[model samples]
Target: MTNLLRWTTPDLALTFVLDDGPVRLIAVREASQPRGGEPDPSQPLVEVAAVGHGHSSNRHAGTVLGRQLRYARHDETETTLRIVQEELTTGLRVTSVFEARAGVRAWTEASIIGPGSLELTNLSSLVIGLASIDAELYSAANSWMAENRWSKRVLRDVLADIVRDPHHHVANSRHAVTGTNSWSTGETLPVGVLVDRSTPYALGWQIEHNGPWHYEFGENRRGGYLLLSGPTDHEHQWSVEITAGKPFTTVPVSLVVGTDVDSVFAALTRQRRAIRTRRPIDDRMPVVFNDFMNTLRGDPTTEKLLPLIDAAAEVGADYFCVDAGWYAEGDWWNTVGAWEPSTTRFPNGLAEVINRIHQHRMVPGIWLEPEVIGVRSPIADELPDDAFLTRHGKRVAENGRYLLDLRSPAARKHLDTTVDRLVDEFGIGFFKFDNNTMTGPGTDKGGTSLGHGLLEHNRALLSWLDAIQERHPDLLIENCASGAMRMDYAMLSRLHLQSTSDQEHPLLYAPISAAAPAAVLPEQAGNWAYPITGTTREEFTFALVNGIPGRLYLSGHLNRMTPAELDLVRSALTAHRAVLDDLHTLVPAWPLGLPMWTDDWIALALNGVDVSYLTLWHRAPGPSTITLPIPRSKIAPHFPTDLGDWTYAWNDDALVINANTPEPAARVLRLE
Candidate 1:
């Protein structure tokens, strides 16, 4: 068979013939880059190594990572990549061209950004931002929310499943097939629009479930020599494997979008939003309140906990969910019906402490590990035989806890009764769900097929969610599966927030804070408020206040604080409340991580009305004047528009905002 490719523009462009097994590419720089293709009828661009799978038990599986490329300078108004592939139906050449919007430049040792290096970029003009890596390609919908009344469990389970299997369906994620463009006048569905531009230049990496439905045919596996876009500051991370017998060379391909890729994506995020999808969030503070008695008693005074909680409240935290380890070791480990206050930590009893929190004018919340019971505890002995999840007639043991397989109706009923008890007993506003991973998938009850045990487990958890939400309508749940393991939109609808990444260093949360806006809800984004060491609280506060619209909880004990510093945190939090209370509309929180410094971090908030941006810097740069250009269109021309006899101000084209502050201040500017 003739090579599928023909040289077009020498190596600058290639034309591919669509028939069968192998395709060819013609290169532009044959001399500078010596690829295997020689001076023939068509000099080859680069010969990509191939493999022939001798059999079909699904063996030879791999992926392509994004490539780091530097192009020769050209005097062109636009940068583009053209993709050409064939349509399976008609064997016609499908072509598409993608225009560049944002990209980056950085210094490299050997010109290849070494293993897992940073300095990433994407074309700056994104029409919409998504939350998390929940691409439709990877997620599948078993029930339509409108028809099934959309249970929180199903949504969360699907998302959790998707997160667990992140890359398995990249090429065929359901979301990938969703509409990505506007209508052709009065066209019916969005599928008709892809007639022409569905070319091979389609991104090589797929984050969706494309090949098989079930995980059995290697369906749920993810990882490859892949390419990732919208990762690491807008850059694509390409991974290509080099092996023996197939000496690695170069290959020519293009990244083609149908010019309207951004517009189509924006429409999907806005008009075509699926309710069961993950949320695009506003950032919030992560308050790590302790649940263990010994941990809180370490502070010696429950009242000392008051100051920290008070600090969080002053910063406008919506609800503070106390974390694990609160009950007495004997009481917490085994008791479900006998959940009494830890006498040592709360000598005054639980009600009094909760009342004190009420006086502080903040919501009180707590954590629970209901699915497990200490082996020594009486409850474990009391539970029915089916209440526990066991494999091969034995329970999975870790650190001396008997795991309750949530699959059982009795197990869920027990948890449901406890959720009711917590809210009824303590007036708890938030519940932070934490676990390592999961026990076994579940039983063979619901038409259980082998290797799909989690099917029943996930279904059981969703069943429990239905019961819990019925008792608690506005119950705010936080998904904390060791930091973002359970982050999925299915849970987002029921859960108020999420704690991303078990890692809590302020710098570590930057990406979570950055990417969350595109997917999770504003309040759900876990903006961890870590103890600042060298950085000014003002800078830290600035970053926190502007970056996230979440809660304010502290970690690592800054028990003693200077009056000035406390006030700075208080002031920053106060600013957060004013915005939260008024949240006219969340335009979008944009990211700015330039000057590439992690020693100091920052997150920005934008108010299109004020036509200004609120900047939060984590560390004070040694005194220097930094001039940032904010858009002039964001400002209002009129000093104050007269409404009858009253005067009011609005930002318009004429306004500009700027600020100069002493080390620790959260400053607001009306573009001067």
Candidate 2:
């Protein structure tokens, strides 16, 4: 006999199929949509793999344990459900938990109920059959400077039909996106979207892990399934020994269903806000001026900062951050972790610059890489080898620095002391925490596997962030791993801001800024807008436009700007502040469908109740006109307020814009 179970949230519906054999998740769709028939029977609710006992006949499926587990029981609450299954031969117990929100947040846990030890190589956090086999897949590729480069691919094109007969064979191949090492988003975002080609139905998911993660979609005998997981034995050298009394849990991931791409992303935006730890500082969404991008460039001195401080304050910056080189006397690359002000660089002291920032009615902030210690630093010698990540009794060193294992009390204490001293001595209110090193697999310091060891350290890092935030409730921290590499909810949930990129060129940053909202919340994406002193008026405005839609991370040598140019900078800030007023309530839409790196024109719309804010950028050097498909509404100039060489008109539901400038330019428009 077959048993069917169904669960519904306000927006999503999940259907499960249970038989005397293994359990399967067959359908996931909008609550209003009808549940379909049994999908691929091999679509297990949770996939697992053990050391000696692996897959039976489907080892070619890239999985080892999905078919061996059988249904045990299930329990449900008003908003949460837990389904338990067991591998009777090995006494392995698995529980799949789901919490209903606007969408569904789910994860899985595994434990052994008997005496025999089980070493796990693979365990999935989520495994469910997608609604359709044919869909448009959306994923992103990330890097140091160029982040959020999204690409669209048809599911069939990527995962070919290798099945000879639909009733006889299933394809073992999979289309996968994997992020290895410590930077969760170093290679690609932990987020993805799928929109059915024939219908408006769509699905989106995000893996909330700060370290390595793996997500793959593959077709079985009938349909397709998505599997999300953390470090695996094949991918990240991660495995754990599970005995009778020990249990292992995979990282948490969230899934949401919507109608179209925009609706799916909007639901994700709402889900991100729901999980974020609310703070007053984050709510205010203050404008920050960091002297790193194109101005100070990690060589800040008292002389270089005083003028910048005044300029940032005069242009309405709420915070002034002295990024990098603050604690170094000279070449600080291999001499970090002391966390003391450089006496030679500042002459008087770093406090002099911090105090000057305070005198200008702005919060003082400093940069620090809390997770790394310079190899040549004395502190490296003071801290025991156990305080850092290690493998085979040797420290894991990369790029002239050692990655701190936050699991160590000594390491956490060192960071606590550094942060406390900076706050107490310099009156710092914000911190820009950067991680520049990528620790390969992880440490085998303990008897655990390298992957398991790294997972523990990753959890320890999050706990440390929580502890410090509790101690300093008002302190704000910005998450930057070489810039947007660690851009995941695992960190963004706690940190106040995320530096979108380290890209210096304004034209290059346009696409990064426009496409960032697809993966990150607008309020948290800290895009850099550095208008050079000698650039043309159009060029300066183009730079500032990159920052307006999101949190305006202001930079540049504003003190040396001409009077007219200075006013323009101030004007950009004023325009940004207006956007901040409704930013938290707005949902983003890309009329241009997620900018391409080489796209000549880009548009981002933040939709609100009564008004919609639009940012239009034309990067080509010539006269051009593009029509944006927006409903006809009363439109007006917003940013420069002068329209310069731009003209606009309305054609039915489309808004037409002509950029007559021979140089690159951009503008912010409002529609009501």
> Per-prediction TM-score, please?
0.52, 0.97
Q: Write the per-residue lDDT of candidate 1 for residues 1-672, one digit (tens) a residue.
A: 443333222212323322232122222221123344322221111111112211222211121111112112112223444433322221122222323321111011111222222211111111111112222221111111000010111112233344444445433221112211000001111111111133211111111110011110111232111111111110111122222221111111111121232222222222112222222222233343432221242232366666666665554455655665455544444343334457777778767767766777667777666656666667677777577766556655445676676777677777777778879988887777665424432333333322223333444565576567666765666665545444443345455566644444444344344434333444455555554534664445544443334443344343455666555555555554554543323433433421122424344444444443344343443332333333443322121111112122334422222223434333333232
lDDT of 2 by residue, 1-672 (tens): 988888888878888988976777877788888766545455788888878866643322435466778888999987998999998778889999998876788988899887887899889998987656799999999998999999999999987776458466666667888999999999999999988998777889999999999998888665678888888887899899888788998999989888888999999998888888987766778899999988989998889999999988988899999999888877889889989988888888787888899899899999999999999999999999989999999999998999899999999999999999999888889999999899989999988899999999999999999998999988999999998999999999889999999999999999999989888899998999999989899999999999999999999998899989999999999999999998888889999788999999999999999988999999999999999999999988889888989999989989899999999899999888
List CA RMSD, all candidates: 17.6, 1.6
Candidate 2 lowest-lDDT run of ten = 56-65
lDDT scores for all predictions?
0.37, 0.89
Displacement of the residue 331 alpha carbon in candidate 2, Å: 1.4
Per TM-score, the best of the predicted structures is 2
lDDT of 2 at 383: 99
How accurate locally is residue 444 in candidate 2, as Cα lDDT from 0 to 100? 95
